[model samples]
Target: MKSRDYSQLMQELSEAYAHHSPRSAAIHQTAVQYLVDGGSNALRTIEPFPPRIIAARGAYVTDEDQHQILDFWQGHYANLLGHNPEVVTRALSEAFANGFGLQTGFTDLLQVEVAEMLCRQTGAEQVRFTTSGTLATMYAMMLAKAFTGRNLFMKVGGGWHGGHLWGLKGVGYHEGFKEADSAGLPASVMKEVVITQFNNTEQLEKDFHRYGNKLACFIMEPVIGAGGLMPARREYIQRARELSEHYGVILIFDEVISGFRYRAGNVAALYRVQPDLMTLGKAIGGGMPVAAVAGRRELLQLAGSEHGGKVKFQGGTYAAHPAAMIAAKVFLQYLIENETQIYPRLAELGAKTRKVVTHAFEEEGIHVRFAGDRLTDLPGSSLHMLLFPYQEGLELSTPEEVRNPHVCDITLSEKVLQLALLLEDVFIMHGLGCTTLAHTEADLEYLGEACRRVARRIKPYL
Candidate 1:
């Protein structure tokens, strides 16, 4: 099929998006009245308002304007069973009927059940529930520090653990710290964190040798989700484990996005490298807000004051809320019952989609990289990408010549975003330009077709 002119197509779609999205516009106006910067938050992962979603079912969301969109984003990779699945809804409903919140110790069965399930799946001895992934990691750090009597921590560069000050320090966004990924965090607070590049064994060994004594723990995403979905080499992870063991540093795996996606365990399971502590979230609660820190008995027991704990404090009123606990339990139950069928199916679908999209980009002469292709035979979830425009032999040219060209002024990034938005308009949504289990073969074909169309549209600029 002949591709349409993307710039002109974008202009036309932009007009249609404005004119046809009256409900979205009204929702955006109302949100702006209450929320700052028109109801937006940090990360700016999603496009700004007229950003209104009215309803969602399995693999689909309907905006306020009633445009049914194919949701590859899948709630930032949280909805493993897909949006509003009957199983999750039933679990939530049952938990709500029992009670939303209990001031004192009420029924602890749900919490216990979730912990037991996680332990069985991940081979962890104990688990602690938390309200969010940030809290889970923070508490894990504190526990590691308390158990080992160390003050400093280490994280791989480009890995996002959470929004906490320490986790954000090595993200390359903060100016005051040596490397800060986000602003507003104090440089003093970040000094305690040491950064190491992923897959760089020499640097990791050197850093461990230099700071192992003072380092409390080393935390990293088994698969770097936000850090462009970079997967660590097995040798790299195994080396980390050896170094940590050698130095007495606790190793923590932040599996927030990986948990319950490929398998009930995680990337750690796939890599066959065990960490001292594993943090989980995203799919654990089946679309609810929940996270966990699981570890060996000695480490987890540090949190309990009754056991002569050295760890300070970790629990909150909502730490083990009945609703979230029940949701997690049901989600795990579903995973256990359908593991053989569900996991293989997701893997097959993911592989096919990656192949189709990669081939489409190659045929169109677009410079795009898919994480799914890079991490093939690896049992994990989430299909992500890092896209750049083909530079037209610009690499061989001198810096001056490359910078002098005004044609390069219009970035490939703008075109990519425009194409993504166009896909959204036609009912295919991406989560920060990534796909997930919610997508089927037909959905991926839809995306591939969209890419072909987009390539044609941007051919003139290229």
Candidate 2:
């Protein structure tokens, strides 16, 4: 087994995925006429085609073909309470019945409640609402720039801040994290944005030293999500704070996937590293579409005023839709009240699943290294990283070390394994998952069994 045949594995996974969702394959064929690439998002892809999830409940999603897949992605890492929790569903139903859904012409108390909760949790004096993580981050960055009176941005390489213009650099870099990520991005925008390696203090120092004067903000996640489930070292965070303070630059934490991810989604607070400004999403709405940018009152005041002081920030038509705000209020209030129960359970389940999956891989002679395994283990975070080493003896001594795409290139393998596990009736996204309150010991058992079965199929390659 010099190297397990990737082609054969891909073919097997492809056939299995196609076999599991005949209706999805058929509908996708029709969908291609309207939906680009037969899907709305890039991560919706699997081998051959993607499945149409007709309905979901708890930890399972049913495909159009009547197959139940045990989901681990959990609504793109937002469904911390699991899919359609009874409380949220009941609340949503009532709100809809009361004509609170869609774009209500009048403002609602739900928005105020959710925003207040966010402010309390993240220590932000003011908060603004949005419908997506990208929007929240865009506003956060813009506010940072306006407050600091700077023109450039600094960010962690491989960090995903959204599809917005300023956060696009260094995301898909193969050679350097600072390289231009997208093709159509303006050369000037690329020049204005600088990328630094996560947890790499020297790079942080260098970037801050050079760009500090013109740097609008240093935006990053306390725990990396798409770039890698890598967590920033405390030393790195401290150094970033020092540099930002010295240079009068705003430090913004994109807590989209991390907020309440651990406890109430304020990941920066867990490490006692308070960001100057922070964005919240995902779990905050408990599967609903909601996001927010919150921070110092002084910086936030620069947005939406009669005089239009420095920054101009405001929500869109559907920015704080009543339905989403209602759902968010219910979700956030529930977490705040049951903080002890939910956060600890999430941490426990996360650690247990990691162990179960890792043991199965090793037992089958598979070489896997979970990036940010330790970081996601913190109090309330439940992000799961499945890192398969390119070779057997690779060293993954630090979080940033494993974030390197070359050393831990699971691009193809992640697809293959994602499908392979689907064949085992377990659903996940590129081996990335977040445990929720809905996940149980039985779910973990089922997931571990699925991993073992998939590992058997991939034993040769591992």
Report each candidate's C-alpha RMSD, comma-separated, in the order given.
5.4, 2.1
Candidate 1, 80-188: lDDT as tens digits: 7678878878867765677664434565677888899999999899998888888899989998988898889998765678888778775642321246666798867
lDDT tens digits, residue span 185-262, model 2: 887987788877787789789988888988989998888887666567788888888999999999999989888877
Candidate 1, pairs of clashing residues: 6-457, 70-427, 173-180, 173-181, 174-180
Location of the lowest summed lDDT over 10 successive residues in candidate 1 = 396-405
After superposition, candidate 2 runs with Cα above 4 Å error: 1-5, 374-380, 391-400, 403-405
Worst 10 residues of 2 by lDDT: 372-381
Candidate 1 lands at a TM-score of 0.86
Count of clashing residue pairs in every prediction:
5, 6
